[model samples]
Target: MQRMLDGLIKFRQEDFEEHKALFSKLKRRQEPHTLFIACSDSRVMPEMITKSLPGELFVVRNIANIVPPYKEVHQDYVATTSAIEYAVKSLKVENIVVCGHSNCGGCASIYLPDEVLNNLPDTKKWLELAQNVKKRVMVHLEDETDEYQREWLTEQINILEQIKHLLTYPYIKEKYLNKELNIYGFYYMIETGEVFIFNYDTGVFELSN
Candidate 1:
């Protein structure tokens, strides 16, 4: 806690002071260009990775970066869904990136038994959003036995699934069809600091040049 406080003080004294004009303008309003959905993992810093400024990306960090399918019936996902709606409809963000990372606990949790997540009811329920990814892996990658390989595949699949889920929103779909919105699936490899982008034309995640 002291470390964070000290950093805050340093930021106020140094970085904030240096960028006072930018911060001052941002104080009144913000117009971010992209909606970045990424994992809540401390290891994955979307801004740091992308070298994005504060007002450049509107970020939404959650467990596994999951984006549930759009539904007419509202449930407990108001926070996530509302952020997406506001980012798209209000902020007019042109790009939406669903970024999933390697070594994601949320993705790994899908392979664990129900008992393991029994005490974490909310987490268990929230992770149900990634069930389709797990099922896809099971049916497609059934012959693969390596644990790390499986997890990596799950993470990539989850990103694609979340992108699909994002399109379920009417406004997003309309904007996307009209070429007003671009959706992207990203996978970050923690060990190597490499980012891969899902290429729609090739149907593969290729390393970003």
Candidate 2:
């Protein structure tokens, strides 16, 4: 807590002061270009990773970076969906990036035994949205015992799955079909500090260099 407080003071004294003009303008309104959806992992810092300034990327971070199918979204848990709706309909963000990172606990939690997942009731329920993702990953891992490969495949597949969920939204689908919106699946490697983009054409993740 002290670290955070000290950081706040430092920001006010240094960073914020240095960007006073930019902050002054953003104080009134924001015009972000992208809606960046990422996992609630401490290592996955969306703004720092993208080098985007304040008011540039409206970010949504949730366990697994999951987006429920439009019709399946529940009234009790509408945080992610509401953010998506507002960003698309009201904010009119031109781009939406669903970022999945390496060593994702939410992705791995999909394979957890029922007994273990029982303690994490909400997390378990949230992760159910990606159960199909586990099946897809398992099929690809046939006869392979490499956990690292399994991890890599799962993370990338999760990103693609979230992208699919995004399209399930009527407005997003309309904008996407009309070429008014662009959606991207990003896989970020924490160890390598590298990003891989899911190539819609190639149907595989490609290094974003």
Which digits, one per residue and each the tens of the lDDT, describe model 2 over residues 1-209? 99999999999999999989999999878889999999999999998889988999999999989999898556686898999989988899999999999999999899899999999999998888999899999898965678888888988888988899999999999999999999999999899999989899999989997
Candidate 2 structure, TM-score to reference: 0.97
Pairs that clash in candidate 1 = none
lDDT value for model 1: 0.92
Q: For each predicted model, how many residue pairs clash, with residues at least 3 apart or on different chains?
A: 0, 0
Q: Residue 206: error of model 2 in Å?
A: 1.3
Measured with C-alpha atoms, the lDDT of residue 129 in candidate 1 is 90
Model 2 stretches with alpha carbons more than 4 Å out: none
Per-residue lDDT of 167 in model 1: 86
lDDT of 1 by residue, 59-84 (tens): 99999999989988895648899999
List runs of model 1 lying over 4 Å from the truth. Answer: 142-144
**Candidate 1 lDDT score at position 199:** 100
